[model samples]
Target: MVKEALGFNILRAKVVTFKYQTVENMSVVKEKIIQEIESIQDEEMLNNIHHVLQNIYSKKSIIILNDEQKVKIAQAEKDYLEGRFYTTDTLFEEIING
Candidate 1:
């Protein structure tokens, strides 16, 4: 537990997480950001932030992909469940010796 100090005594803890947002709250968030940016006196700093944001926004989102065919993948999964899959060193030895 996360304890905080009260008068030389440990108090209660609180937890926070980021899963609260849904699709309906976009406009309120945008309005607050716009108000914050307008309140900023340095337009140059805002433009720099905008440039970096655009670069990050425009990049392709990353995804990890498995190269195995679906049938082979399923078979390998079954082998794993049945304790029959190979280790990395065994696979390397097979490749080197074969």
Candidate 2:
């Protein structure tokens, strides 16, 4: 199996090769990285890696809502504040009886 992370193609196998480095096992890569990190004393390099990892793992995105969507969301919030929502049982009963 192969997985793509960022732009790197990760091969899930006993032996994986990337560029000039040969990793013995994909499962041990994390351990190897941890060991390397533990031995590294360079603050600048570690900080760079920290920032890179943050960007790679971050899931935040900006969602631009249109006027109609904004209005709908505002109406929904108002309805919820005024106790205008239906209970699950009532909604199911109405659906079944209809």
Candidate 3:
């Protein structure tokens, strides 16, 4: 029933132990997602996705990414996890230099 109604092959309805009594919960979830999408739009998420796609399809763009790019991103994530991330000073400098 859910698959037919929602047209999503990747998702399934989680069996609820207690039934939702009102539309309020569903509406709140929808509104929250809308708000988050709006925030992402303002933060230029679309531009970043577009940039990634352009790079992916353009012959001039990298067809094969180097290990350095992968390592750099992984290290950044690791640093963030360890709470050892660079200050805005370093970030700004890197952005400016790049």
Candidate 4:
């Protein structure tokens, strides 16, 4: 039913589609980036990329706990799973009453 006849054909119908590319995981993306970096021959660009990476890594802080701390954390987790930990309301009540 074409009233104004803008560009419609009642007898013919067509459908169009486009396919997009996708990456499966971080490993594939990381490998692609590494391959691109290896292909670059510009010394200045490589130095700039290296400096940026160094700065990014330097800003991160890592915590290394001793064995005793690890054991305490594991025990706390076990206590939680075994219903040995107190609820937030209970702790808050004790804090306020004390």
Backbone atom clashes (below 3 Å) for every candidate? 0, 0, 0, 0
| Candidate 1 Cα lDDT to native | 0.67
lDDT per residue (tens digit) for residues 1-98 in model 1: 23434523421222112223433367678888899988989987787667767767877643323456666778888999999978899999999999
Candidate 4 Cα misplacement greater than 4 A, ranges: 1-24, 60-98
Q: 41 in model 4: Cα distance from truth in Å? A: 0.3
Number of the top TM-score candidate = 2
- Taking the tens digit of each residue's C-alpha lDDT, what string does model 4 give over 30-66? 9999999999999988987887787678976445566
The predictions' CA RMSDs to the true structure, in order, are 16.3, 15.1, 18.1, 13.3
Pairs that clash in candidate 3: none
Worst lDDT run of 10 residues, candidate 1, spans: 10-19
Computed on alpha carbons, the lDDT of every model, listed in order, comes to 0.67, 0.75, 0.70, 0.74
> Which regions of candidate 3 deviate over 4 angstroms?
1-64, 89-98
Query: Model 2: clashing residue pairs?
Result: none
Clash tally for model 1: 0
Per-residue lDDT tens digits for candidate 3, residues 1-98, read 98676855433333231234346677898899778667774456666656777888887764444689889889989999999978899999999999
* lDDT for model 3: 0.70
lDDT of 2: 0.75
Per-residue lDDT of 47 in model 4 = 80
